[model samples]
Target: MPKFAANLSLMYNEYEFLDRFAAAARDGFTAVEFLFPYGFIAGEIKARLRDSELTQVLFNCPPGDWAAGERGIASLPGREEEFKRSIERALGYAQVLGNTRLHVMAGLLQYGQDRGRHLEVYLHNLAYAAQQAAAHGVTVLIEPINTRDMPGYLLNTQEEAHAICREVGAPNLKVQFDLYHCQIVEGDVAMTMRRDIAGIGHMQIAGVPERNEPDTGELHYPYLFGLMDELGYDGWVGCEYRPKAGTSEGLGWFRKVMSNKY
Candidate 1:
C-alpha cells in the first residue's frame, strides 16, 4: 500500500492549527503535509512535529498576500524579488521540519497580461526555486490546479505540468500530481501517471466535482493506487480533501486502504 499524509489545513479544519498535528497523529497518520506553515515560527512547528513523531512530506512556498487574494507571486511580473525571498524562507522551514518537497504555486493570470511573458517569468522563477531547493536537499514541485476551483491558474493540466518540468530541465523540479485537479482538467488519471510518473514528485487526492472524500469520487482510487504500486511509487500521497463529516468519522475509506507507512 502507498504511504498517506493528512493535509492538516484541509482535513483537520475542526481543530486549531497547532492541535491538528496531534489530531492527525492520533488518527494514525505518521506523515502529514499542509498548504502553508508561515503563520507559526519554525521552532514551534518543528516542536509539534517532534512531539507527534510526524514527518511533514510537503508544504507550499509562501504565496504573497494570501489575504489580498494573491494565491502566489511566482509567475506575476515584478514579483521575482519577493518570490526569491519566499524561496529562501521556505528552505529554512523545510530544513527545520525535515520536509523534502515544496510546491511553488504559479500565480493566476490577470486581465491584459501577456501569456508569453508570463511563461518566461514562471519558468525563470521555477528554475531558481529548483536550484535553491536542491541546495537544501529538497525537491521543488509544481502542481496543475483545475480551472473550476481556481480559474486563470497558470498551470492547469498534467500534460502541461509534465512539459514544464521537462522545459525547466532541473533534476530537483517535479510535478505535484493532484488527482482531483487531473480528474477535472483531464480524465485519464491512470494513463497520465503511467506516462509521466517519473516527473512526478508528490501526489494529492480529493473527490471529483465536490472536492470531498475520495470514496465518493468518480475516479477509482483503488485502481489508480494499484497502478502506483505496480509502478513502484513510494512517495507520500497527501490526503488533501474536505470531509463530509468529522475528519475522523469520514476516514473509513482512507483507513481501509492504508498500510504501514513507516
Candidate 2:
C-alpha cells in the first residue's frame, strides 16, 4: 500500500488549525503535510507532531499574500531576494519539524515578464536552494498549479515543470505532481505518472470539480492507486481535499475507499 499523508490544512474542518495534527493521527494517517505553517511558532508545531507521532512529509514555503492575489513570487523577476528569504524561513521550520520535502511555490507570471528570463532566474534560485536543502537531507518540490483553479499561475503544466527540473539538473529538486490539479488540467493520470514518476517527488489528491474526498469525485482513485503500485512509487500520497460536510464525516468516505484495498 502507498503510504498516506493527510494534508491537515485542507482536510480537517472540525478542529482549529493547530489541532489537526491529532485529528490526522486519529484518522490513521501516520504523516501529514500543510500549506504554510508560518503563522504559528515552529517549535509548537514540532512539539505537537512529536506528541501525535505524525511525521511531517511535506510543507510549502510561504507564498505571498493569498488575499492580495499574489499566488507566489518565486519565479517572477525582481523578487529573487524575497524568494530566497522565503526558502530560508521554510528551511528553518522544516528542520524543526524533521520535514524531508519542501514545496517551492512558482509564483504567477507578471505582465510583460519574459518567460525565458524568469525561467533562468528560477533555475538559479532553485539550484541554490537545492544545494542548501541537500546539506540537511531535505528535497525541494516544485508544484504546477492548474490555471483553471489558479488563474495566471506561472507553472501550470507537467511539461513546464519537467523542463525546469531538467534545466536545474539537481537531484534534490523535483516536481510535486498533485493528482487533482493534473486531472483538472490534463486527464491522463496513469500515463502521466508513468512518464514523469522519476521527476515527481511527491503527490496529492482530491475529487475534481468539488475538490472533496477521493471517492466522491469523478477520478477513479483505485485504478490510479493500482497504477502507483505497479510503478513501485514509495512516497506518500497526500489526502489534500476539502471536506464536503464536517471533517469527521468526510473522513468516513476516505476510510471506506482505503478499506476496499484491504
- Record all residue pairs in model 2 with backbone atoms less than 3 Å apart, i.e. clashing: 72-107
lDDT of 2 by residue, 1-262 (tens): 6788998888886789889999888888899998889999999999889999999999988787878888776777788898888888999999999989999887777678788887877788888889888988999999988878888788888988999889888999999999999988888888999999999999998988789888777888878888888998999889888888877777765676568742
lDDT of 2 at 20: 90
Candidate 1 lDDT over 1-262, as tens digits, reads 8888999999988999999999999999999999999999989999999999999899999999988888888889899999999999999999999999999999989877898898999999999999888888899999999988888888998888889889999999999999999999988889889998899999899888788988886888888888889999999999999998899999888777865321
- lDDT value, candidate 1, whole model: 0.91
Question: Cα lDDT of all candidates, in order?
Answer: 0.91, 0.86
Against the true structure, candidate 2 reaches a TM-score of 0.95
Model 1, position 10: C-alpha lDDT score: 94
Considering every candidate listed, which one attains the maximal TM-score?
1
Give the residue spans of candidate 1 off by over 4 A: 259-262
The best candidate in terms of lDDT? 1
